[model samples]
Target chain A: MKLKDILFVAITAVLFGIVYLGAVYMGAALTGILTPMGLGIYGYEPFYGIWFLAAVFTTYVLQKPGVGIIAEMLAALLEVLMGNFFGPIIFISGFIQGLGSEIGFAVFRYKKYSLQSTMLAATGCTVLSFIWTGIRSQYWTLSPMVVLGIFVIRLASALIICGFGCKLLADGLAKAGVLKGYALGLGQMTLEEE
Target chain B: MEKLNPFLKGVSILVCGLILSFSYSVLLNGGIIAVSLILLLFFSKARLTSLVKILVPAFVAAVSIFFTGMMFTSGSAIAPEAVSKVESLNFEVMSYSMTSVYNAIQLSSRILAFAGLGVLFAMTTDGEEFVKSLMHQCRLKPKYAYGVLAAFHLLPCIREEFAKAQMAFRVRGIPVTPFSMKPVFAMLVNTVHWSEHVAMAMESKGFDGEGARTYYTVTVIRWYDWCFLAVTVSLLVSGTFLLPF
Candidate 1:
């Protein structure tokens, strides 16, 4: 990867790290509020997609082979350094989720930055990370219905936020002319010219 | 513990977490929580108040998980009828068996153990040292490490920009929520703008990401770091097998 690619990934990680930390607090608060309703598990579920944002967002903007993994891992590292409550396990989680996002783009051979590709990346992130959640959170202990509920919510959140949300954000940035040198920017330029 | 190599410390904590995942023994999980706490307090010099701050959310999360586990556990000991009754909220008092309760405790305690390990690493290790250690000990490329470090330092700038954007929005009478994307988009524009300048400036300053470079601070992998790693792994492995509950 070029120096700029590395820098962009790191920057994205740091930027989203702040947002992820906020989401963590939000998840905790929501979990607390929902505990009495027997729905605490679902509290974090809604925001799970936010965790995959760095990976999906980076991959979409960079259109690279491994930027998704690197960005997500870097974001997790930043979270740890920022004193995230979940700690080091998040690093492994980042790797799993990043791989999921990458698989989405890899399916199209990194040629297409279409909505379908980002959604697939988001789906990949949700499914792969769900297994990790199952192991770490012992989701198997929960009733299948509850586990299914969590999965569906998380998948939807990933699809909406990480999938379409990232594409939208990138398009907005590109429109504003800030994405001038990046692959996404060049792609947009070509489309405009054609 | 604070003096240990950051990479080894992270690996040890991660390994211990992985080991804890393979079983549902409460004793092993409790041991991890205790050891991590003790290391944090006495060895790592983490203050009591700060530890409490770190733990309050964890305690809340654990409690929530515990309750959720108790109410919805799919333990085989519980009859399918009881599991089905949970959805209706009309279960008899006998629906919750001892097995479900045990599963709940196991799940909650494991959460605590993972949190403890995370806290131990986050509190003890300095971010810069960890990144430097990654470069010195882990042989991470300077390009990535330095880029990460540079971005890490610019976090305050990002925060400031966020606040500025939020204020700018408010001044224009635009309604904004914390979750609003407008300010976030504004922040991204500036981030993308700054990235180019930052990369160019680094290049101008003789920053060669792929080239060999000397380090001002070197993190050594000492015998005790290995000792810490070995002792941690052994204790966790032995605990997993020997612990009854």
Candidate 2:
């Protein structure tokens, strides 16, 4: 990658972190509205875990190995600094979710950009996040029905937002020419021409 | 000109959050004393507007929970065989309903406590000062810290963009409901694109990723911060022993 590409990636990661924090706060506000409707049981809904989408989109466009984790950690750090309600728990969840997405990238050897790969990465993250939620919260003590409902909502969120959302973002960035370097290897062209 | 120091402002937020959270937990555990403590804290803050905001949601949640508990619970005793035979079909349904209601009440209380604390924190704290403290006192990297601050400041910009996008959609005869994920997704993509350009422009300016950075402002940890931390720790510790419910 060119110096510009590296720089852009870093900058994007930081911006993504900020956006992620804002999304979480917005999500919390929405949670207040939805809770009374019995729809709030799916924790992290409304905001739909948009940070995960941000991570997936960043990594997919940058096609970098640690992008997912770095973006997520930055976002979590930002959220904590912003005084999120869950405090330490937000940091812990960020680490787990980042690792989950990073694993998917590693499995593909950081060479793939297909929708299927992105979806797999998202699903992997969903499962990891779900497991963590169950262990961290009182989810284990709940009845089977409640547990099942939580799992379905989380999984659907991951697929719908992180999976599909990343694809849509990548496509848009490509159209805008901003993603030409990492995603399309256009950086190589600029170097060759120079 | 009643301006509180940013660090002190942050400490107060943390203090209020801990108090609210502890009292909430105590109340959940059914400790009347804990509930009283929470009410006391609420009164001392003298934030009438904030109290109203918190009360509306908390009251709604509490009522919903109570009703849910009542709906799903089975009464104290099982019906006798004769009564069971007469009400056999209805008994199981009633029991299930009551159980769901009870579960809802418990869940609602927990959620309310967390939500209340969140609202309280957001209302009292200075966002920029919080970021500055994180960088200076908390040892966060300047690059990342500033980026977060920038994003926070950029929120209004994003909202403006979202509004513009919605207007554009309406002009195109597209629906603009918040529930419609399609418009939201489109708006997000546009926002990200805008952010990328802004990031690139920032990079083009001699913004190199290098050396020790100096802060334009400093955050000193004061006696209030220490006292706040001590009170928070004590409250949390005492809460463990007191079991409100």
Candidate 3:
């Protein structure tokens, strides 16, 4: 990666680290509120998308092979530095999720930035995270149907948030002319054309 | 503990944490938590006060995750026979289930162990050393490693700049909520600009991003690292998987 790109990833990771912290705090609270009602993992559906946006947006902006993993892992490292209770697990989680989200761009061999590619990343995250969290969170204890329901909800969250949400944010930046020099920025392959 | 390579410490923590997370034996989890806490308290650099600082919040997180885990209602998660023996108690606005409560205790205790592993790693490992090890042991390119290293050193400066930017916004009468997009836009624009400038400046200073570079510091894994690795891996393997479930 270019030095500029590397530094940009670092800055983006730090900024998103703050966002992750807030989202996690809120997600935990929602879990607390919803658990009594037997809503289970479904309560956390909204927050799942926010977790992978850093990876998605960074990959979208840089269009590099490993920027997604690096950005996501760095964000998790920042979370550790910021004193998140989950500590090293956050980094582990970031590694898995980022790799999963990178599938969208990777499937096209980093060439395609289409909406379809982005949605694939979300669906990828949903499937990967389902297996990953199932073991850790003991989701197997829940009925198969409920586990399946939670997985579906997570997929929608990833689709809407990482896929569409990141698309909008990047485009908003692109249209404002801030992402001028970047590869997939507004000057090249504008979202309108896509 | 102090003698172990930073990278080695990271790997050890990660290995044990994975082992702990992979299984659902509440007894093993609790045992690991108890032993790790004692080892960290005595042998690691962490003080009791700091351990408590991380643990208290972890406790809260564990409680939340535990209850959430219980609501899964899987047939095998908790015995179907225990469902009827369940009772409910409402604390005015909140309700609880006896079976759910039992599962919550198991899950929460595991979370506590999970959190404790993190604390052990963070408390013992120095961030800079870990970064340096990444460069030497992991063979991370100078461009990325130094880029991140510089970013780590410049964190305080970044905070200052962000604060200054917020103050400027306040003075300019711009409405800024924490979740607002405008601020995020501004931050990204500035970060990109700064990254470009710094990259150019470093290149001009003869800091090439490519080719082989000699390291000023070395992070050789010592005997203690080997011992630590053996002890942790064996303990995790035997304790988590070998025990009868």
Candidate 4:
């Protein structure tokens, strides 16, 4: 990858790392508030998509095969540097999630950057990472119905925040001319010329 | 602990997590927590306040998880063979029994173990050194490593830009809250623009990832790093096998 590409990915990863940290804090507070209601386990579900943002966004913008994985991994590494409570486990999560995102794009042979692709990418992330979550969080010990409930919520979150949000963010940045020189920006330019 | 190679330290900690993933031994998990806490307190230069800050929340979260696990875990959650081995306690609440209690300990102890390892790594390793070690020992490309470092330095700038964007939103009669996405998008756009400039500037200064370069500070795997890795792995492996449930 080019230096500019690396920089783009790095900057985006770092930026989203901050957002991920905020989500963690928010999730913690929500977990605390909902503990009495016995819904504390689901407190972080809504924000799960945000965790996949760096991967989806970078891959969508860069339109590269491996950018999503690198972006996600870098973001996780940055989170560790920032002293996130989950530590190296986040690193493992990032890898799994990023691989999921890449698989989403890979389904289209890395040819498509459409909404469908992003949605699929998000689903891939959610499903793949859920496997790790299942093992790590002992979801197998929970009733099947509850596990299903958690999966549905997480999948919906990924589809909304990561799938749709990435598309919207990339379009907005392309319009703002910040994405000039990237694949997404070039696509915009080509459309204008056409 | 701080003197250990960052890369080695990370790998050992990751190995510990992986080992924990395979088994549900409370003794093993508790051992990890105790060792991590002791290292954090005595060997590492972590502040007591920071240690408390992590520990208190971790304890609270673990308790919550324990209760949740106890209440939700079904009697037949495990395999039929394993379920038969679990002796149901007389003091049962709903479906909760001794089996659920065991499951709960497994769940919460895993959390505590992960938290301890994570906090230990975060506290002991310097970010710069970690990156340096990645490049030097792990053979991560300098371009990628340095790219991360540069972006790390840009964090404060990005925060300032985020604040500015929030202020601008407020001026435009848009109610800005911590959860608002408008300012975040704006900050991201601005940073993307800055990144292009940064890349161009670096290129102008002959920055190339492909070129061979010399480093001012080098990280080599020392004898003690190997020892640390050996001890950590052996302890985790032996603990997993030898420790009673």
Best by DockQ: 1
Query: After superposing candidate 4, which stretches have Cα over 4 Å from the reference?
Result: B78-96
Candidate 2 C-alpha lDDT tens digits along B1-245: 01334444445444544454334342443332344336435534536665564456445545544443343323432234534555566867665554555455554565455455444444445567766776677776665665555555565676677678788888999877865655554556565555556556656875543447566888777676677557655765576567644
- Candidate 4: tens digits of C-alpha lDDT, residues A1-194: 78888888989988888887788788888778866755567778989999899999999999999998899888987887777777777888999999999999999999999999999999999999999988888787887777888899999999999999999999999999889889999999999999
**Clashing pairs in model 1?**
none
For each candidate in turn, the TM-score is 0.95, 0.69, 0.86, 0.95
Candidate DockQ values, in order, are: 0.74, 0.21, 0.47, 0.69
Supply candidate 2's per-residue lDDT for B134: 66
Off by over 4 Å in 1: B75-96
| A13-61: candidate 2 lDDT, tens digit per residue | 4445555556655655665565565444443543454657656766787
* Docking category of candidate 3: acceptable
> In terms of TM-score, how similar is model 4 to the real structure?
0.95
* lDDT (10s digit) by residue, model 1, range A45-69: 8888888989888788888889899
lDDT of each: 0.86, 0.58, 0.74, 0.87
TM-score for chain A as predicted in candidate 1: 0.96
- Once superposed on the true structure, which residue ranges of model 3 sit more than 4 Å away at CA? A35-45, A81-83, A89-91, A144-146, A186-194, B69-71, B78-102
lDDT of 2 at B61: 45
- With candidate 4 superimposed using the best TM-score fit, by how many Å does residue A64's alpha carbon deviate from the native? 1.0
Looking at model 1, give its docking quality level.
medium
